[model samples]
Target: MYKTSTKIHLYTVRSQMRPALLLSMTLFSLLMLSSCKKGSPGSVNDPGTEPQPVADAAFLQVSTSELNTMAIDNKNVLWFAGDNRGAVSGLGNKNKNVSFVRVADQVKSVSVSDSRSMIIKSDNSVWTSGDNGFGELGIGNAVSNGNFVKVADEAEQIEAGWENGFIIKPDHSLWASGFNHYQIFNSSYSLADVVDTYQKIADNVQAISVGQAHVLMLKTDGSLWVCGQNVNGQLGTGNNTEQRGFVKIMDGVKAIEACSYHSLIIKTDNSLWATGHNEYGELGIGNNTDQNRFVKVMDNVSALAGGRFFSMAIKNDGTLWASGYNNQTFGITGPDQNKFIKVADNVTAVAASEYHSMMIKSDKTLWATGSNTYGEIGAGSERSLSVFTKVKLK
Candidate 1:
């Protein structure tokens, strides 16, 4: 009887071992399955699943009524802007208007630097042209020379206001000319005066941005100075009175932008402040009331752009935010409310025109929103959209 009982105990132990072995095998299978499902990072079994190649850095291609601008910062890529009436790409030397020369033929956009002189920075060195009506071209009123003529000494930076122009000298001084309806061009209180004012404050100007009727400057002291049309309180002076000269509006400004009727400034803290027309809630103040003083809109802002009647911004995390007039006429979606709304994710930089908006992602992909009446959005379609749509530029 003792032998039989021992045998029974051994049988029971064997039974338990079988189940344990099976359980171990099951766990191993699951681990293998998980590994197969996830695969290796950045590897794809199907070629179709691979991500499309994009440029290494962010850039933009913009077009105005009479000109186009292709702004690129990536060292490995070349930027090109085609003319509204021309087409040339990859055909060697055909009769196409797609070459870099198109940028020189028409004076679409111009940028100057105090150290570089006046560089059209477009396609060729052909950097100055257009109305020159106000000598805004800085080429001394040579009207018959309808084409862009190079200026001898380049400027540190150039700013084009509604009807005026300003240049920053190497000495950190400011020089300006053209229309100054509200003393914006008063020789006594012009660019030279601005440089003097900045000197008195122990601040050096680094950059300048001009709005339709206002001027904004960034001082080395991290403060923002504003002047010009204040009829709609776009000056952010805490009042609606027009400022004949530059006045300190806020401090710690890291970047600034100006629109046709509004202004925006981003502080070092990644916060945004906007003043001016709120007719479409462009100020993002939660209401349509005009803001004469700077008001906080959101945080973590990395980049921003303004349009004639709307605005857009990007956060550090690559999320895109837009507000104001999002109508078909403007190339975007709804203005839902007086607040910023996320439109897309993974955006790197944003650019805005009077009626369209464009963005470049870290992967070098481009996306657009708003109006496309003139192929400004580059979709070849003339529909207005609220959400972002990818742009195929190959």
Candidate 2:
């Protein structure tokens, strides 16, 4: 999680930058346990306890990163932040497990970041919470708000950026607010200021994935666009130039995932392509060299995710594959950093962070691995999990 202060804390455990990134691709992150045991929260124990309630097909959505890990349960509700008012946001007690709270009816989904969270109900009315220092919440002012506030009412999806928010309206138009890094919001580039209110940027947008310093937008026509910092060519524009305006990166792209300084896209052919920082070979292209243009990574990918310096993908066979930054998060060793390694089977979805990972299995149960410092992994037990463990969700 980003410190409310101006400094960023590094989680050496995973050897990567910890942004409120990942667990945030067209799904959510920045979510909280909507309900907890009525009394003091207890340690989330593992195994041989109560059987996990079956996850609903409609509520398979899950995301996690930085201090808060959350999901939309079969009942259409889960965790939340700021309830503890601690550095990472949560039930506040780092030692306590999570809980769920029923959301108002018609609540479609929620997205979160380091300090703020945004919810889009069925009515498309947007509500926000957390730090508004830069007005990322679009609450009409820069006042830092800890409680959820009604910000915008539209239709469609939303994503929380490193310190901003990306919104897709009912008309398929794109809108955004907060830190304007490299003008990803489609205006003058300025890292020193922010757009306090949501502003429209484009039209015919299908989906968006905001990374730590860059963003990827997928158009309704299957073309991909990018903007922002590219010191490592994350934009895949054939150069490392900072893009102040959205530029076409590729086409026939059916899905996209972005993280700190890298990106991955799935072509209509089901082949995977990648670009950006590869210091840890997170691109899964068999090398550590960064690419200024999208390079083929593999074929037969159904879904993908990007983390600090690593990536995860689900194959057509329901197997989970991972690569880069050799950490326990991927269930592989340092020697496997440059290549994709099968991590798990019968996996349906996965979410990652700089030091942890979360997965939803075929059984609809939640499982996690890697660091649990902020209980981001929330596997019930607070110890660092080198192997994926079934999480006991109340």
Candidate 3:
């Protein structure tokens, strides 16, 4: 669900490394800490790195996609996508006080994986750059390009998966490219089925959430459909069998989120449902057992964000709750929580990554918590935080 009584998910990006045999590894034991940036090969969780200064100004808006966090400063300056060193761009970095690198002009939104990035210009055109091993850039070839290339037009929304890209048109049609190992296209995605360009896959789609190897599609009719890997019952199809085609899993769904091996579903009735990988209580069901079918979790939820093995939910009353994989990573001093724990209130939005979590409060102030191996937490240092620390936007 866009916000759910259920859990939500975000894919586990390989960071700086991309492996072609991701599916060959065990889900519970895999700890891929890869990167998309070009310069660093150090441990993503390294703690000895020197601290860097960070800008902390009020923001008008904040957004997080995958491992990137971006915000528009109150002054209209665009901050670096939060993955790179703390830098802001746009407005030409007029303020010599801040080092800004202009990414693009007239940009509306950005989506990035560990190795590639896609930008939607204000004119409704989609551009892509970086790794294109599977033609995820949608530039009509598998050759990688460092510069952004226009890939599609008249797009309404874009999403970047591990090595895949998706676009939604004004007509609500879903277009996809890149890896299809799990058959997100509703057809056999054999080794020869590498899609080098975008192709229409479904229609009447209102929203979509991509998981490590699965996808959740929300239709205008409130139907939720799923495809891709289900080794851990992530597809919520009531079995561990993989789905090679779009299969309807539930109805009256309002929003959905997918990540790594779990999914969160919000119903039109304001109820939450969760399914798939729950080894660490990512499902927030107060237990560590796995679920093959969609199970009810909580209610009164309005927003949701799922991390590698944890889940976060926001109540309509403005309270934010978190569960699963709670440790020093979440700044909590207890064992992993199988149940939801109240963390903060007045939260408006939140984004979860494999290691870090970013959120925006009602005041539009940004806060981040978790691992900071790559200075992703923007805490002015490479030290990991044990609490939701306020981060400056400017």
Model 3 TM-score, all chains together: 0.77
TM-score of 1: 0.67
Q: What tens-digit string does per-residue lDDT give for candidate 3 at 1-394?
A: 0211222244575856456445544342233322312113432323444334444565554445434554555555445443431112222221222122335556766655555666667788887666667877777774543556778878887887777889999999999998776677655456358787898989999998887888899999999999888988888998999887788878899989897899998899888889989989989898998888988999999988887888888889888888889754454566788888888889887778776677778887878888766555555556677788887532
Q: Is candidate 1 or candidate 3 better by TM-score?
A: 3
The residue ranges of model 1 lying beyond 4 angstroms of the native Cα positions read: 1-69, 73-126, 144-147, 152-156, 169-171, 186-203, 328-332, 381-387
| Ten contiguous residues with the weakest lDDT in model 3 | 85-94
* Model 2, residue 153: C-alpha shift (Å): 2.3
RMSD of each: 18.0, 16.8, 19.3
Candidate 1 per-residue C-alpha lDDT over 285-351 given as tens digits, one digit per residue, 9 for 90 to 100:
7888888888899899988788777778889899878778876422344544578877778877777
How many residue-pair clashes does candidate 1 contain? 15
> How would you encode candidate 2's per-residue C-alpha lDDT over 201-294 as one tens digit per residue?
8899999998887889999999999888899998999998888878886789999998788888999999988899999888988898988899
- Compared with the true structure, the alpha-carbon lDDT of candidate 1 equals 0.58
Error of 2 at 43 (Å): 20
